[model samples]
Target: MDNVRIFELAKKLNITSQKLISLLEEMGISVRSHMSSLDSKVAEEICRKVKPKAQEKATIPRSQEKAQSRTSEVTLAETGRKKPVQVSPGISLKEFADLIKKPPSTLIKILLGYGEMLAINAPLSEEMLALLAEELGLEVEVKTVEESLLEEGEGGTPELLESRPPVVTVMGHVDHGKTTLLDAIRHTDVVKTEAGGITQHIGAYQISYRDRKITFIDTPGHEAFTSMRARGAMVTDIAVIVVAADDGVKPQTVEAINHARAANVPMLVAINKIDLPNANPEKVRKELSELGLVPEEWGGETIFVEISAKNKTNLDDLLEMILLVADMQELKANPHTRGNGVVIESRLDKGRGPVATVLIKKGTLKTGDIIVAGDVHGRARALFNDRGKRVKQATPSQPVAVVGLSAVPSAGEEFLVVDEEKTAHQITAERIARQRARIAGPVRRLTLDDL
Candidate 1:
């Protein structure tokens, strides 16, 4: 008799491959992949374990099944006591089920009863998990930490550790002079690039302030895209909130503040348009205080600076504050290892085919390196710094526009440095195949008879 793979057996049993894999692992089968071949005798044993013989199935009574479920539920309600299972934030339902010593399928059925149809890998908030645990007669404890979906970069030796530039994100309401401030700093007219003076795209730029480099990420307002603004806050080391002195705080300004706070980054308040006659710096300060931003001048923690992009007043002070904050944070990264970072933006160019703006969080990205961003993989044929200068290498905390990806990756996707081109292609192919399999996985379709 020929051998069969685990997935084939799962299909025959009308179950998912993932469930089969988990079962095999629990059984100490030493299986690595669902494609791993099983011995003929072992496959038969597995089939018997998953499903009983036809005679047994016919003999089992429906009343017995209901009684068994009721008994299990009653046992769970009476057995457990005060032990709380510790779980990370946004833990998947399957993982939570395992933590609670229950089968994932049981939890899935419970969720279905609650009208929440979720994937096996879908995450549940702590509150939701607590409710589920309560029903299961279990207790759960949540662990909090600064979270990042990006993969950890390669480690570095002491000699390779160096201070990197600070990645700053500018966010605020519309007409807050965000792009204009960046234009003044970079000494270029990027405000003209946007239609109607509203920045439509995320722009990363680098500038030298008093001999030190700072990379600025100019994020679009929520009117353009809320996701873009959220991405900006997540990736940045510092957030410079540009509140118009004349306008104080607007609706979008509060949105920006919330985004920054959620990212848990240090914030600096920039009182822009201070040169205007109607500009009230004191009124802006009072409004920010109400929002929990007590200025340093007022004996609070936040650092605030008054500036005018048009008149070029106190621009240096803002830059100095950014550098000071970066120094206090003590940002350092490894330059000798492979690069890993988030994709700030991606677009197709008529001339260049596909291009992406990548901000390196750790390690160094060089030309000719194989990179994988999401399911897309390609060689780094070229790299240009934020200033559009063609560069041979990019270090940590630097934003570079890359050319030669197989496809334009989605904004905010984390890219990893792969060892070889063939390996990169293989990994990307596996990822794509997994995505396709998930899409084609078993789903309960709606039927007219059910309706």
Candidate 2:
């Protein structure tokens, strides 16, 4: 009976083939054989043992019929299509609003009028999910019996609710110990630890200070940072501007400040080289003030900490200050929801293939999560922390390296996890189309004098 064909079981049980498939999926079983080849004995056994429960029709409730009807009308009116909305499981309302170009408040009102009490931060219900899918021109269908069976066979802990860490980018001039400072914070000589003493590209690392985790993006201090800023990708969350105490603010320091301002991320001034003989903290603060980064002690919005990355002085204070700023911003995202993170950097690793260092903003990412990275999509097979240690899953405020992408996603691209591979590919295609549209649009002309 268990091995009977799905169609035969559906016929013997007097149920729709689709409904039978749904039931099998719910029971975590798979149906393989066709109806014509189904063994009569097995089909009879399945028919005798399984029967649909007497229940109400699978129709919208009377109270919600008007809302559902309106939703269907709106979807058709907008897209000129009568297809049902396909709501991917585990996506958040804010994400949905961004996807459909509607304000979250408007979406919430629409959902509330339909008897859904979901908050902006709350997870979507199945009925509400259906409504959203309809509005977005997607198909809704129940899981197949085979899929349910597969899910059961892959027993693993579902993602937990956790806050993702912020992606921190360090910007300063050459010889500012930007790499050395990161090595000191992470307690590894990554600079010298590399094959060569030079870091050729952007490297991402995750460091834990007490229980809190922070992801650091080591961006090239040369012209690349400026180039990245011009693109408006601005992949960094917090900018740690390293200013040598003795050297004070150099020309590159000023450029770093402008880059941080252009990206619109908060800045923290770290007065490095304080342990040196010629290091002067007061002089550096005065110089920084001229660049508009007034220290908090001097009634400025920016927080300045004096430290020596070489001797590891006041490193604890630096970490604590970063966390303090993060708290003030209320940097949080629901990890139990689908993955929503930013790509700090991407590269091809010889051993791991295509790898992306992502700073999870909201939602949790685990092994096997199908992710859409810009124009690329793939299922994550391995995750590595900033220290290059393998981890099962990364939560909010975590920086992790993900492998198994179809291609190298662009740096600063936003990542989202989809419910299936097909949906992931669809999203990637849409993003590519949008990018093409942007490039094909008119280009604005600016005079050299503007510089």
lDDT of each: 0.78, 0.71
Candidate 1 residues 330-354, lDDT tens each? 6777655568888888999999978
lDDT of 2 by residue, 202-249 (tens): 777777777867888787764545655665545567899998888878
Model 2 TM-score is 0.60
lDDT of 2 at 13: 65
Q: Which stretches of candidate 1 lie over 4 Å from their true place?
A: 1-159, 222-233, 433-451
Considering every candidate listed, which one attains the maximal TM-score? 1
| Candidate 1 structure lDDT | 0.78
Each prediction's RMSD to truth: 25.6, 23.7
